[model samples]
Target: MSERVMPGRADGLITLDAADALWVDLTADSAVPTASAAFTCSPAHARAGYVLLGSRVVATVKASGGQWSVLETEVRRAAAELNAVRMDRQDLVRIGPFRGAPKKERNETTLLRWRQRITRELQELGESERAVRREGGGPSHLAGIDWRRILVERTRDRTARTWWLPRAVVRLLDVAEHTETRWVQAARTCQENTAVPEPPSHPRQARDAGGRQTTSPKGPGASLRPYNGELEGQLYSVLSGKPGTSRRVAGWVCAVCRTAPATVLDHCHEHGYVRAPVCQSCNTLERPDHLYSNDIRVANHYARLFDTDTDDWLRHWHRCPGCRARTTLPLPHLAAWTAHIACRSLRPTHHAPRGRKPCGVLRVSWTGSQNAPRSCLLTVAVDFCPSGEHRVLARVPYREAVERFRIWLAETAPAVAAAAGPDRLDGLPAQFRPVIADTSGEGLALF
Candidate 1:
């Protein structure tokens, strides 16, 4: 019976008779079929390499010369055309039989497997490309040999040529071009050395005290110290207690500075006991063990903690500008009064009112009990005004007063020394002379 020829669809789905016509059109230009002409035919016709008449698969008729070669050439041309079209439309290029999902969607295991497959494919392609290049051939020769190019050639529709192997691998894996190139080079190096490429190193997991690896709480480079559950629970108990200790502590000001709010829990490191709460700076600086070893006054201060009649160490005496009497000031008020003393001390000694003699001078005195006499009381007075009024600025504890003075001197000593010349250095206290000596040539001459 004569076979009935069905009409083809507009979407390139051709009937058995149309498939035969396509084969004839493909091979008419030459004795052998061309990949371009084969590609021009419907995908169904190219893929099948035969016409489907009802249930029977009927292969195309052979060309005139070299019948077996003609048949093989036709099948090959059809496959190349079919593969190029598939490569253009495929969402993920196939590596062997396995095609992976997008990188974001894949699990670790699947991603690792895909990476291995891609590396192997790259290594194989490199070997093939090198072999071709050594035989006076190039990428055109690799179109048939390099499966990666065959699987990932997007430019086939425009130029009818495959991309470079590394570029093709990049498109196939949906990776950066340089990343694929690195992989290719690594694979080639491994192949040359006859060794398998090492897998990429994952980020190191943080370990606890027990040496068990644990995921870091704050990602990579986070501290490895384990969270103390019991300590945290104890903290929560203290904070949520009936007396509201946290709120009470929040209300209290820094014990040391007495101005800033106390935010840190100060502790005696040697005795392993809690002490008064203080600000961050006071907490950091108040190392009793180190301070007591170096400073006699600090040792005395700590030793006096047990005494029933403890001296008022924080109390400071200053001549009040309004009262004109030595009035007691708190620690904060004393700090301000001492700052005022430093400001007056830094002023140029040569500067005075017109027609007034420059007899302005600063006077400092120290006082303490005979037993603990390390100059605990520091009294600073200045007589700089035209009236020659001897005004007592502050009578604060020596240590804190000296510390504040040192800070002020470091900033203003150069300007003061330069303006006042050699005579200024001669009048300064012996201890302060060294600081001025470093900043001025006239001060240096005193040595």
Candidate 2:
């Protein structure tokens, strides 16, 4: 902590025996704090300090549970304990490491200031002490103080200065002083053969000397300037995840879609070349669709077509909703036709075994001979059913064959339509028909 000094007395001091006895006897204020504590010049450990803040010492210990108050008892006991053994370092499991070696000062100005602090604390606490009480007409403990303040006050001269403990209390903290020592050796790896900055001989000179520091501006032994990520005259190749640039800035964008424009000096995580940087959108989310699916190809082709037409389409041939695709003419057909020949194509057949007369005129034909004109003739005698109505019909091919033939007809119909452009569709020049069916007697009805 910041040190304070009084002319005749010191502040807090502790004893190892007292600390040991603390847990067993909570009444004893010697418990080592499991938190943080700072020590300055105090009456309890006068020898441990130079002369209050002027030429005094500074020490600290960390507590186990952020118990800062424990630091007071711990440091006091440490100073007293170390002084007894003359040991430089120690290990106190609960308390942190500590150093007794005082930081030598250049002038007495610091010490003078410490003295002023002690004088102020005394002024404030002096009048309040008389009315202090432990439980009944006595004084209460501070963090860990007890009403038995005489021995403590007498040793540290609390009356004259604000004595918190005795100098001998340092021994109580010694057990952990060195063992908790923080030994840090900061090793830097400078592969680029860069210069390092040197430590300041006089702190103020380094700060206020018009930028003229005691340190060498260029030296192999000095510390490297923080770099501030500043790569002068060049980019400070920065590379984290995703696309990045060489140095911190000023690199060309990588033509390679996803690779970085540049690599970080010491680290590179990506698999591709870190050549140049890319724009923010490209790096973060925007990416090209690279797969070639049929939809994609179609879309691409459609896009190309759109460049000229602005719209491209396909024809959907209409079909009977009930029968799916059954139709004489598809909606997509440009032209279609049917050839109607007048004829009586069949006669009724009989159930021969049931005394039924039968003269079924089925259209029967045969090829006459090879190497000769075939007589593939078809005959249908005038026919009558039991109801006696004359009907004419021709047996076309099978269903599939009829469908295929229909498609063929639709295909060739356009050409036929073009030629028929020179003539009428019915060869008689037709008009819309009023369709009627023979449903009356004699199978003939007037419409």
Candidate 3:
């Protein structure tokens, strides 16, 4: 018997008859053949034969050069045909019985038109295939090639050369690693059978015993309610009633952002009134009640729409009395601003009337990319009383600003104690004591 050399395992030698027998064994079973199988072939021999068959198929297909491209063209043509058929059916539904024509006649004419269109499409497809055949690129030339197995193996080989990681394969193919693995398994089955695998069927909703779908229309949880067409119509009417709106004058551009093309009708969910046409992003942001209040630009723009003053909108920017510079800060920074002012008041340089402590109003401002909250320039300003001049007190990095505030709090603890009197220190507000105790490095009982 003539001997053949295997690619792996140090160029292992096996008889041609034994190799044929191993190939037969691999194809005969759905699962990988074991050493104890009736064919008496080891798993290694079976794997080697399987790989050999796959390589031969790949080589045969490659010999036909651009046959895969021809196959892809055919696939796209078929998809276009399917879409055309769907559109034709929709046209028939919309046209119904043509005017001055009987129902039967209308259907027969429609069927004839469809048949003619389909025949023309099929003739074009046949001519293209014939041209490919003339160029030595056709289904006959690539018969028994198992293209799926070839593709999967090629993907695996390329991925192995890089990092042998599924993520690397995913980046190349734009598919989940698990899905790629499933494709590999399916391709292996095709390799065993020496046949092209059929496209996998899409998963469909489960059907009950009565043949009705059991899945909810809303989805798995059944949380979403069906859309109300009447309410939508009413909203559309209200939107159209408004003159010189973006939807009417500027086409479909977003009324708020004026960037993205509008896709949805923005409305007040509480009042059930239409607002304007906006993009999906703006519509989502508008859902929250405090959206306008938090965004000054949006608030001012909407206020103008209603012909109101800018001050009618939420004011986030304040001008310093001393420096006369505008300071913009969000509402959340108000607490920190107040605390910083109180700390400044306790400074020895801030003199007050004989029996009273100095009182002041504080405003906070920050500058940085909103995406990077940790790194920011935090500035605090205080309007000191009597003179009532508002000036910037501390301008530092966010972390440094916080540290300085804490240090000021620690230094002011003795002054706070003295003002309240030692006996009255324990009677300070509960909320004020925890902050003082923590910063002063003293137990809460010491307050």
Candidate 4:
């Protein structure tokens, strides 16, 4: 009998009749044949096949060779242009539905016209109301805004509720135009124009609302008089040189204390201005007359002490014990850490004397990043001692303090942690952790 060989890793031989039987067999136990021969299906076809299995295909696009790339490029470019137009129109309708017509003329009639115009534009761009209404993917930042509010309201009835862009449909119009959401754009624009003073080309005395020239006897205005021209010119130059600085400064999220959006533009009351913005808490905590108030050195100082990142003024900069003495010294890590733990334990008195000072003393001081932009000064001190008097001990720059703490913890924490018992892990905040045995001599491995 003649033997037939099956391709690939198959049993030795089979008769033609047996091969035909194998091909015809559809039993669950039968092995399916596999081959890497030329596949007639292209990647596009395979993708299409998978997509066809789905309920809906958003867009059915066909492209061949170089035309595909060109089409893609054109689509993207056209899309971007359309998005810009849509957003600008949306903003226009949002802020002024009357399209700069007199305020008295703005009413439901004008709003209907504006909506019709937008709808026509969308249709011309080959987009339908259904497409515009479809929810696109992204995070929504405005918590207070209800976009569904009327786009235009009658001037007389504006007191109860005013007009806003139609939210349900318009918000879904273009999700990508979100740099300045319509909800906050007006507030942001107002803040930018008014929050920071614009220097006049020529030094004219700043006037109050009554047209009387305002005087600042003890404030920034006092220093502005003598060098008004020079200062004003410099201020203009600085502000203009860095165009983004104003926006960044105004939009600053407080780096100090990790607080929410910073409202105050921090500056040197004496030197005029610095670029960084600080939260209300950090800005108000220190006396304005203090040396570090306008200096980045102050920011660096506190960051080092707490092993935190520094980009602005520290809230506790005034807490430096050596500020009065004008000299600071290094505090041992062991003593500083002990004092930290002790300070954490002390609670505030409910009805204590109103003017009583807290029980704490500065023991250590350090300065890091000197002569550099990032230069920082750090001071560590003990608070809540048994004796009424708080004594100054040592001070080191924040960087050194961090290293000292890390080293001390690494060296001493293992034994201490072992002594903490199994209960050491319980009732502790996520940040507080017992020392591990594998601590390095270089520093505390964990924060």
lDDT of each: 0.31, 0.23, 0.29, 0.28
Mind giving the per-residue lDDT tens digits that candidate 4 earns over 1-447? 113223321112222232223222311121211111101111112111111000011111212221110111222232233233222222222323323232223232221222334333333433254245434322111111112222344354643322335322233322211211221343244446665532121012333223333211121111211111211112222553565654444344444444233434433222222324444334433222122322221221232344432112222221122210111112222223423432334423223477644454334333433222146554544435555344333344445544454444334344322332334333223341222211111111110
Ranking by TM-score: 4, 3, 1, 2
Scored by Cα lDDT, where does model 4 land?
A: 0.28
Q: How big is the positional error of residue 134 in model 2, measured in Å on the Cα after superposition?
A: 6.7
Superposed by TM-score, candidate 4 places the C-alpha of residue 54 at a distance from the truth, in angstroms, of 51
- Per-candidate TM-scores read 0.16, 0.15, 0.17, 0.21
Best by TM-score: 4
Clashes of each: 0, 60, 0, 21
Query: How well is each residue in 155-239 modelled by candidate 2, as lDDT tens digits?
Result: 2354232233222222222112111111001112221233652221211122111333232122211221222223211211223
Checking candidate 1 for backbone clashes, the offending pairs are none
Candidate 4's C-alpha runs over 4 A off are: 1-244, 251-260, 264-278, 282-358, 363-402, 405-447
Give the Cα-based TM-score of candidate 1 against the true structure: 0.16
Per-prediction CA RMSD (Å): 32.2, 41.5, 29.8, 27.6
